[model samples]
Every structure is written in C-alpha cells, then in structure tokens.
Target: MAILATGQPNLEAGQSQSLHYDDFPPLNSCSKLKIGTPRLPIVPSLPNERECKIGLLRNRHVLIGLELQEDFINVMAKNIYYLLAKDGYLYTMKPLIYDAKFKVEEETTLTMAWISFPDLKPTFFVKESIFSLATAVGKPIHLDMATINKTRPSCARVKFQVDLLANFPKFMEMETVNEDTKETKIERVKIHYDRLPRYCLHCKVQGHAEEECRSIHPELHQYVARD
Candidate 1:
C-alpha cells in the first residue's frame, strides 16, 4: 500500500523550479549581502530671510523710540557721523554773552594796565621805552591796544601808560638821594617797599629797613630800629 503526506509538493516539480545542487552548489544561505553606495545626509541652508526680518524690526524699534524734534533729530542723526569725525565733543550748547565793558574791567583787574597810543606812527618809540623800562627792572611787560575812534581824526598822538602798580612793589623800586651835605657826602636814603626790585619801589636807607612806612601802616613800628 502507498502513503502520501499532507501539504508537501511533488519532488519532481520542486526540483525543476529550485537551484540545482550540481550547478554552483546553490549560493550559501548565510552569505554576506552587499548594498549599493550609501546616500549622504542633507544639510539645509541658513534662512537669510529670517535674519533680514529681525534686522528690520530692530531698526524700526530704534526709529520709533527716538522721539526727538524733527529738525534736531534729523540734524543729529544725519550729521552724527560727520560731526563725530570732525569734532571731539558730541554736543555744543549755547555760549554766554556779556557786555564788553564788564569784560574789559575784569581783564584790567587781572592785567597790569592799558597803554593808549594816540599816534600809530610813534608807537614804535613807546614800545621801545616800555621794553627798556621793563628790562631795566627785570620784569615782564605785555603790550595791548584798542581803537578810540572809528572814524578818522586830525593829529594822532600815542599816549601809552604802564600799570606801574600792577605787580605792586614786586615790579618797581623807589630810591631817594640825600644832597644836603656841603661836600655831597653820602647821607641816609629811603628805599621804597616793593614785591620786586623795580623803578616803583626801592630802598636807599643807610641803617634802616626800606619796608618801614609811617603812613601806610603805623603798626609796623617794630620794623623801624633806631640806632
């Protein structure tokens, strides 16, 4: 008697469709499989549009926040670069204006004195005299001038005077000579008090201090020593 198993295909049909053992021994079931070349990962480009939008938003905010006067803002903003390049300081406030008389008085108090030169041509002689006098006393002298009249006039005379009392005794010295003696013998002389030895203040005393003055300050009696 013959017996048949269930769900099994006929052996002759299976052999006709499958690999033949004699032909290449049928590829091994556990052989390594090779895949095609792998594809590289893709990297998206940066979003330039988003960056531009952000920049635009920031600029708008700055413009909106700058609530300044139209003209002033325009001047400052438009000229800022040029002004910064040219000037050291950013802003310049208004300057204070005062009368010329006040200014002149202030200057005079700090200055020696103002010399008047009526004649412009003779100014050379005046300048020479000032230079000589200043040099003789070893003091610095500065010359300055101003116009008296705007229009033309007749004969012009240069009247120049120095502030001999500017530096007080420092720039001047006074000396007195005694000519009472018959033979013109050396007698006692009086030297003036001065901050410096100039033509304004000088002492010419034999045995006394030149700073002693009875008219200026009587309390300075201690400075006078009688022999």
Candidate 2:
C-alpha cells in the first residue's frame, strides 16, 4: 500500500503521519539495525485531554493522529524516531517534511554534512565559540576530533544538521583580534562544505540538482524531437 496524493501534495512537521503497523518482530528479522522485539506489549490509550493519537496500518507499522487536518504536530517528527520510546524501544516513524510543499517520498532538505571553515581564527576553535558561529548557519552536531584538539590547523571542520532548502552563505562574518593592533575586527571567513549531496532547488528536494530535475525540465525525458 502506498500513500498517494492529488491536486497538491503536502507533508509538514506539524502534521500527523500514518505508518504500516506490525507487532514488533524479532531482532533477527532486522539484522541491518539489530533492533525491535517480539513482545507486543499493551499500549495504554492516550489521555482524553492530551492530543496525538495513534493507529495501526496493515499490522505492519503504527501511525500517529492528531486534531488538525494536516495531522498537527508540536514537535519534530525525527526526534520522535529517537526520543519517543515504549519499553526502551524507539518508535519507528517516517521522516516528516522539514519545509512546506513537499512529500516524505522526496525527503526534506534537512541533511547532515561536514562544513569546513577555512583559515578560521584558531582562538574560536573552542566548542562554545564554534557552536556560536555554527548556529548562524544550522545546528552543530560535533567538531572534528582534530578541530577539538586543534591538531589540524589548516581548517576547522564541524558536522552540522543544515536545511538545504535555504541559501548557504559562502562567507560567515566573525569577530577576531588583529596582531598588528589589539582591536576587534569582523572578518569574512570562508565556509566550505567538505561534501554535499545533490539538492534540487526547483523541486525543493535533497538528492538531485535543479538542472537535473525531471519535474522542472520534462523535455529531458523526450528522446525523439518533434517538428
């Protein structure tokens, strides 16, 4: 069974997502992740006052429901994949849309990538400082071990969870001190991504580029030219 849409397709964070429901299978069933159990413990019913509802699908997955039509959600859906657990098992959930006007099938632009700061001021390599600067772009996950230890002095690398839908600044303005004179200065520091997956600006999906997007350029599909 597939989730289909018509007219306009939409998947948003503040929305409920239905899933294929199945009683937990043995860990061997999922050797890749080595997770889940066979025990199908009773799930207590949700409180009448509280929102967030749940339902089973094809007895394969469990999906949540809410009051709003878009399946209202107050917290991020990804977090639920890690945070919300029953009997020490995290709830399996489909990735939700990070931005409006897309579907989970295409995936949200949110991604984890290593961003490098070329010739970054060494003094700012500290966690607090790195995080402070990184926040200007996105959520900082961790600093490269070499960066944390200041072993690799060429550049500082930090893994961040960034939204690909937004523009990435080539330079980040940072305050630093000059050797010639003990004065504060805001310098434009170069920011580089060690590597990045393709992202389509036209379709607003991460994986392929805009020019390579078939949806934006349907002619790319035409093999025979018409007169």
| Number of backbone collisions per candidate | 26, 11
Residue-level lDDT for 69 in candidate 2: 21
Instruction: Give the lDDT of residue 61 in candidate 2.
Output: 41
C-alpha lDDT (0 to 100) for residue 180 of candidate 1 = 46
Task: Tell me the lDDT of candidate 1.
Answer: 0.22
Q: Please give the lDDT score at residue 173 for candidate 1.
A: 21
Q: Write the per-residue lDDT of candidate 1 for residues 1-227, one digit (tens) a residue.
A: 00122321111111112221121111101100021211222111211222111111111111111122222222222111211112232321111111222231121111122222233233223333333323322222333332223232321222222333343222222111233432322111111222221221332211123355434456875665789
Q: Which 10 residues in a row give candidate 2 its minimum summed lDDT? A: 25-34
Among these predicted structures, which one has the highest TM-score? 2
Residue 58 displacement (Å), model 1: 40
Q: Global CA lDDT of candidate 2, please?
A: 0.51
TM-score of each: 0.15, 0.50
Candidate 1 ranges beyond 4 A from true positions = 1-125, 136-142, 146-167, 170-227
| lDDT score of residue 41 within candidate 2 | 42
Model 2 per-residue lDDT tens digits across residues 125-205 = 776666555666676666878999999888889877677766666676555444456566655667788666677877765
Candidate 2 local Cα displacement, residue 68, angstroms:
31
Model 2 regions more than 4 Å off: 1-106, 177-183, 201-204, 218-227
